[model samples]
Target: MLTMAIVILLLLMCATIPVAVTLIILAFVLGYFYSDFPFYLAAGEVLWTNSENYTLIAIPLFVLIGEILVRCGSARKAYSIMDAWLSWLPGGLIHANIGASVLFSATSGSSVATAATISTIALPEGRRLGYSEGIFSGAVAAGGTLGILIPPSISLIIYGIFTETSIPKLFAAGVIPGLLLAALFCFVTIVCSVIKPSISGQRAKYNWKTRIVGLFSLMPLFLLFFVVVGSIYAGLATPTEAAAIGVLAAVGIAAAGRSFSIAMFTDAVLGSLRTTAMIMLIVLASYFLNFVLSTLGINEQIEALFSGMNLSALETLLLVFCIYIVLGMFIETLSLMVITLPVLAPIVFAQGFDKVWFGVVVIILIEMALITPPVGLNLYVVQGVRKRGSIMDIVVGALPYVLAMFVLLYILVIYPQVALYLPNKV
Candidate 1:
């Protein structure tokens, strides 16, 4: 029965069915066939109650902040500041693409939005500067994944809600690993450029004075990041409240940049609404699927299957890693996470793994998923903005960063403290 369900899911997703509809159909199918009770009746209640969750309110607010940044020219400004500081690196503007992404991720807290915002700003610049378009777009896609790994991440918030974990602690834990993964990406770029300097764009060295002045331009972003992420870390605001505050700060930044108006704000709100609606729909459907599976005793089946393998905890984790990598290749990163967590979270806890640590590891996997081929959302995002190249260029470019993620994953597995230290301090 489980195998049949998996086949149906893979087929539906492969056939380009919308994920929310796919999940809903799969849930109802499972409930109708396998359960003695009329289980589909509970879906409406499940969705409604979950939709009303206060923690979930943060999604729209974080999304609004990203939309405002994208619309108001703040994202472009942030990119330029990164260019001024980092364009002289061996990989030239490639570093800036990543630096800007890291900065943007702090505020956006979303992978797709970060990719869209940064790629829109950086693609033309990278193209004109003579950087290899493939690598440039690839770098943007990879960097955008940081949006979910960094604090104030929408993915982390969703994971917290699904697993009943501490959202603040999850945020705190992601800080060090997220920054480290970003630094590792830089190192990969530098190494790639050094190996084949021809792949790099024309390098430009800004004067110390201009660079110094550009530092002030970054102050606004810093303050925005601090306001959004800082408020949470300081225990002064909940994630939802911090997201609300960030929305205001984003509007202020837009207004200061002379891009604010009723029309612009309305557009941002609409974009936020569209993105949030899609996310909420999938989330609601996933919650129902989770409920259906629970009522069907899928957890017991999963435990039985793992026990039949007689694998140690480490071996079980390795298998889970393989599952994510394979599933990631086919499923959209966000949908894959939302759907699979229902099954995988129980496995993680059963292995005596710390929930917060596992959350960070899961995010790293999601980051890998964001760059992989076929369904990598960021690849399409970057390619969409570039609009002139085969997305395979992005796939090729992002391939190297996958190695960096593997390194980060290996480090966390070997040294769990890397993810745990900040959370513990918190």
Candidate 2:
């Protein structure tokens, strides 16, 4: 049954079917061949359950905040400010691309949004300064993946819901690792730039006074992050409520910048609704697929396989990491998470690992997915913004950061505290 299901899934995906539709098709096929239960009825329950999730409300709200910020010119301001301060680094403007991503990720929970927003603002700078296209584009794509790893992340919210873990703890757990990953990306960029001087771009020296002035431009983003993630941590708001607060704060920031208008709000709402519909479709389909898999004893089969191997916990984890990397290269990140967590979460939990820690690890892998080839969403996003380069440029550029992710993955495995410390402290 597993083999058949996978075969059908591959065929569907290869035929260019959408992820959500492919998932639903697989669920129906699996139920028809393998189960006696009514699949249609089961699907209805899944749809209803997904529709009723309050935590899921965070997805659209956060998406709207990102849209508003992007349309209102905050993204450009962030890039300029980060470029002023971080351009002094070895990679020049590339560091700013990453720094801006980290700051924006705190507000925008969508990787595609982060990549798109930063690409628009930073790609022009890269071109004007004669930066290496591959590295510059790769940096934007890779850095944007931080959107999933940082706090107030929609991906983490979905993961928490799937695993029944604490959303706040997952948010807390992501903080240190997210920042660490961002630093590693910048380090990789610096090393590459230092090794190949042409890739470094023009490093414009800035005075402290100028840099300090640039820092002021970052204040709105910082405030939004504090209000959203801070409110959640301080027990002042649920994730949903925090999302609402973020939307309000984002609107105020837009208004203060004189970018708020009926047309802008209309565009933001339309974009948010479109993204939300796509996400909710996948969410609903995944829930149905997960329900079917559970009913068909896939989890029991997996447990038996693990037991038969009698592998150590660390070995099992390493195996799971390998699986994620391979799958990450092909599947959309959110769809990958939704489809796998149902099967893998129980196994990881059974091995005495923390669910929240596992979530951090998985998110890092998802970040890797965003830059990986074939189906890496961020790579395409960055490429779209470039409007001239081949997709492979972004893919090749992201390779180094992908390596950074692998290193981080093993480090997380060896020392789980990297992800758990903050959550534990809080």
Candidate 3:
């Protein structure tokens, strides 16, 4: 049954059906044929429940904040500020790409938004500065993946909802790993630039006074990140509450930049609504599919099959990693998470792995998916911004960062503390 489902899903997707619609079709087919109850009716209830989730409310709020920042031009301003301080690094503006992504990702929980925002600003600048297309575009694509791994990540919030873990802890856990990934990205750029110095262009020259002045521009973002993530850590707000605070802070930042306007605010609201609707559709469809699978005892079959293998925990983890890396290539990130987490999370727990640790691991894999070929959304987004480059440029550019992410995965596997330490302390 599982094999059949996979085949049909692939066929449906190949036929150019929308992902949400494909998921819904699969759920209905499984339920109608395999289940004892009317799964469609149950689906209505599941959809209603998921829609009412206060925690899920964080999705639109964070998306709205990101949209507002993008529209109000604060994102570009923020990027320019980051460039001033970081362009002096070995990789020159590439360092600023990662640095800006890090700051923007803290506010924008969506990787697509982060990539688009940075690409819009960074690509033209790279062209003007004589930077290598491959590395520059790659930096934008790879750096944007941090949007999902960093604090206030929509992915972490959804992971928390699915696994019944503490969202705050997940946020706490992601900080160290996210920053590590950023540093690794930077390190990759530095190493490559040192070997082929021309690939990065000259280290950008900025006066110390000018750089110090630009440092002040970072304060708004820092304060906003602190208010949002800090509120969660200080136990003053739930993740949802913190997200609401983040929205307000983002609006204020946009206003401070003198970019906020009524028209921009309207566009931001519409953008948030559209994005949220698309995400909720997938979430609801996946939830319904999960219910159907559970009702038909497929989940139990999966559990028993894994148990029968009697594989060691480490071996099981390796197998899970393989599954994600393969699945991630074809599916959108959020849809992939919603579809797999229900089945995979339980198995990992059964193997005695920490869900919090595994959550970070899964996010890393998802980050890779965003840059992987064929369907890596970040690649397309970045390429679209370039408006002229071959898509291969984005793919080839992001490849090193992909490798860096793999190394990070291995490190996490060896020492789960990279993900668990902050959560444990908090």
Measured over all alpha carbons after superposition, the RMSD of each candidate to the real structure, in angstroms, is 1.1, 1.1, 1.2
Per-model lDDT: 0.90, 0.90, 0.89
User: What lDDT tens digits, residue by residue, belong to model 3 across residues 286-354?
Assistant: 888888888888888888888999999999999999999998889889888998999989999988999
On residues 1-426, what C-alpha lDDT tens digit does candidate 1 reach at each position?
Answer: 678689889999988999999998888888788888887678778888888899999999999998898898878888888888888778999998888888888888899999988898888888888989888888999999999999889999999998999999999999999999989999999999989888887877788888889889778888998998789889899999999999999999989989899999999999999999999999998888888878888767877888899888999999999999999989998899998898988887898999999999999998888999778999998888888868888899999889999999999999999999999998
What lDDT is reached at residue 119 by model 3?
Answer: 93
Give the poorly placed runs of model 1, Cα more than 4 Å off. Answer: none
User: Model 2, stretches more than 4 Å misplaced?
Assistant: none
Candidate 2, poorest ten consecutive residues by summed lDDT:
42-51
> How many Å off is the CA of 277 in candidate 1?
0.3
Q: Model 2 lDDT vs. the true structure?
A: 0.90
Superposed Cα deviation of residue 273, candidate 1 (Å) = 0.1
TM-score of each: 0.98, 0.98, 0.97
User: Per-residue CA lDDT of candidate 2, range 8-58, in tens?
Assistant: 988998898999999999999999999888889867777897789889988
lDDT of 1: 0.90
Counted clashes in each candidate structure: 0, 0, 0
Local lDDT at 261 for model 2 = 100
Clashing pairs in 1: none
Cα error, residue 45 of model 3, in Å, equals 1.5
